[model samples]
Target chain A: QTASPAVAKPSRLGLCASCHGETGMAVMPGAPNLAGQRLDYLRQALKDYRDGRRDAPVMRAAIGPIGAAELDALARWYSAQAPAAASAP
Target chain B: QTASPAVAKPSRLGLCASCHGETGMAVMPGAPNLAGQRLDYLRQALKDYRDGRRDAPVMRAAIGPIGAAELDALARWYSAQAPAAASAP
Candidate 1:
């Protein structure tokens, strides 16, 4: 399938997937899942990171360059993905 | 002081602040704000909407009876609040 621009291009979601995993399932202790997140919620988060509302040194830098369109795509992609299986390891 | 139990009980970020307000912003138009997100990405989006793996049927019944120390006190009170400034309305 032809991935959307957000999916095809490097996006904030991609940055998130770097640690949160491609499906929003956090692979590490600190990362978190983005899969199935509310699009509105996700959008706001990206905006937060970009606008310096949220505080995450890495996240701010990560989401800094992202734009609205990309953020929307990211949100849609993650929101559509299935939530990762729960496993407390 | 004392507002800890996920901001004094009633979590899921207080039902997403009854519509993503209370700091997270997102007054309307799909609601998204959540000021200063990122507490491990809000604890994997409340464990992917309580293990359904993300799909928002009203956020899986509103995080389906949240736990995990109230989602880490609502991801450390919306990652310490702040964000919420940009307006697209």
Candidate 2:
């Protein structure tokens, strides 16, 4: 029997997984955890980053040219995630 | 009978609560959430801010003069907190 391909979880956070872990925990101190944020908040923030309302060098590069619908999808994916409980590193 | 003062939770995140929320969830887009981060990462971050290794204007001001023990305490408190689940805002 052939093994099934690993299922991809629904998320628009593809690039976000670099500094922010695949699970939404931030891998770098400079990065913020994205899990469990308010969807509206994340949406607005993304908009701001795209429009230069927020001055984040890293974010500016990361958010380059992505438009609205996908932004919403990203927000939906991240906001839907519940951050896991603290545990040993 | 005197009511006892509300007991302070153990944390060095006093100023952090202004933007990061009392619960380690960041209120601002530019600010990163701290919940569920590894303790060592958090400690190193706070130290970076304190020592000018990190260039954050707000953090530079916030981390002024705190001792090593307090930075450790802050990391401990924050890392111990599991971010609450996502819910409708």
Specify the highest-lDDT model's number: 2
For all candidates in order, the CA lDDT equals 0.59, 0.67
Over A1-89, each residue of candidate 1 has an lDDT whose tens digit, in order, gives: 12233344334555677776776555666655555456666777777777776556677667767777887777677655544333222
lDDT per residue (tens digit) for residues A7-67 in model 2: 2344556687787666566677567666666677778778888888665688899889887
Residue A40 error, candidate 1, Å: 0.6
True contacts kept of each: 0.15, 0.45
Local accuracy of candidate 2 as per-residue lDDT tens digits, B1-89: 11112323555666887877666666765566666667766887788778876556788888898898888777776666666554444
Q: What local lDDT score does residue A31 receive in model 1, on the 0 to 100 scale?
A: 59
What is the C-alpha DockQ of each candidate? 0.11, 0.28
Stretches > 4 Å off in candidate 1: A1-13, A87-89, B1-89
Q: Clashing residue pairs in candidate 1, if any? A: A24-A33, A24-A34, A40-B32, A53-B83, A54-B36, A83-B53, B11-B14, B24-B34, B24-B35
TM-score of 1: 0.48
Off by over 4 Å in 2: A1-19, A26-33, A37-76, B1-11, B27-30, B87-89
